[model samples]
Target: MTRTTSALVVESAGAEPQLALVTLDSLRVNGVLVEMYVTGVCHTDLGCMEGYLPVQFPNVFGHEGAGVVLETGNGVTDL
Candidate 1:
């Protein structure tokens, strides 16, 4: 089953970030589900958000975060 979560989303280039409900697909093989405690929008992310970099929009805002691993899918052993 999939889960619903809240995230800061950018709908298009130069658009303001907004809080939205997003879906999480079932964990795939070797996938890890993290529950983020703190997330950040770094310069690289800002570049992508500002249209300075080529990226697809309707995108979630963050690549940097600290969190606990809630679930580990099959084939994961090094965590």
Candidate 2:
């Protein structure tokens, strides 16, 4: 199955974050999909956006977040 979702994307170094639509692949076994309700961008993200970090372009950041599990795939035994 195919799915689409919105994401904050940085097209390249020094590029501002933008809301973009992204596709999703079928969930793998034990995979989970989360809908983030709370997220924060720390200095690390800012550094990347400012081209101070060595990370590649066209990145998806914001790992500091909390979310609700919307779906769980096969082999998932606990929430």
Candidate 3:
């Protein structure tokens, strides 16, 4: 089943970040779902928010993070 959660989203260039309700699809084949407890805001995330990166808006930021594995999809053997 799909799940909904709060996420930091960039809706437009040069706009402030906003908290948005996002829908997450169920785990796919060989996919894993992580419940992030701690996340870091880095230079890249700042760049993306400042339009320095050629990234699409309404995108989720913060690649540097640590989280627990909440679910694993089919054929996923490694944790």
Query: Could you say which candidate leads in TM-score?
Result: 1
Question: Per-prediction TM-score, please?
Answer: 0.93, 0.81, 0.89
Q: What is the per-residue lDDT of model 1 for residues 1-79, given as tens digits with 9 covering 90 to 100?
A: 6989998899998999999999999998899999999998999999999999999989997888999999998878888
Stretches > 4 Å off in candidate 2: none
Kindly give the stretch of ten consecutive residues in candidate 2 with the minimal lDDT sum. 54-63
> Candidate 1: which pairs clash?
none
RMSD of 1: 0.9
Q: Write the per-residue lDDT of candidate 3 for residues 1-79, one digit (tens) a residue.
A: 9999998888977788789999999879899999998889898888888998899978888989899998899889877
What order do you get sorting by TM-score, best first? 1, 3, 2
TM-score, candidate number 3: 0.89
How accurate locally, in lDDT, is each candidate? Answer: 0.92, 0.89, 0.88
Q: For model 2, name the residue pairs that clash.
A: none
lDDT of 2 by residue, 1-79 (tens): 8789999999999888899998988888889989888899999999988899889878888989999998999999997
Candidate 1 backbone overlaps, count: 0
Q: lDDT ranking from best to worst?
A: 1, 2, 3
Which clashing pairs does model 3 show?
none
Number of clashing pairs per prediction, in order: 0, 0, 0
Output the worst ten-in-a-row residue range by lDDT, candidate 1: 70-79
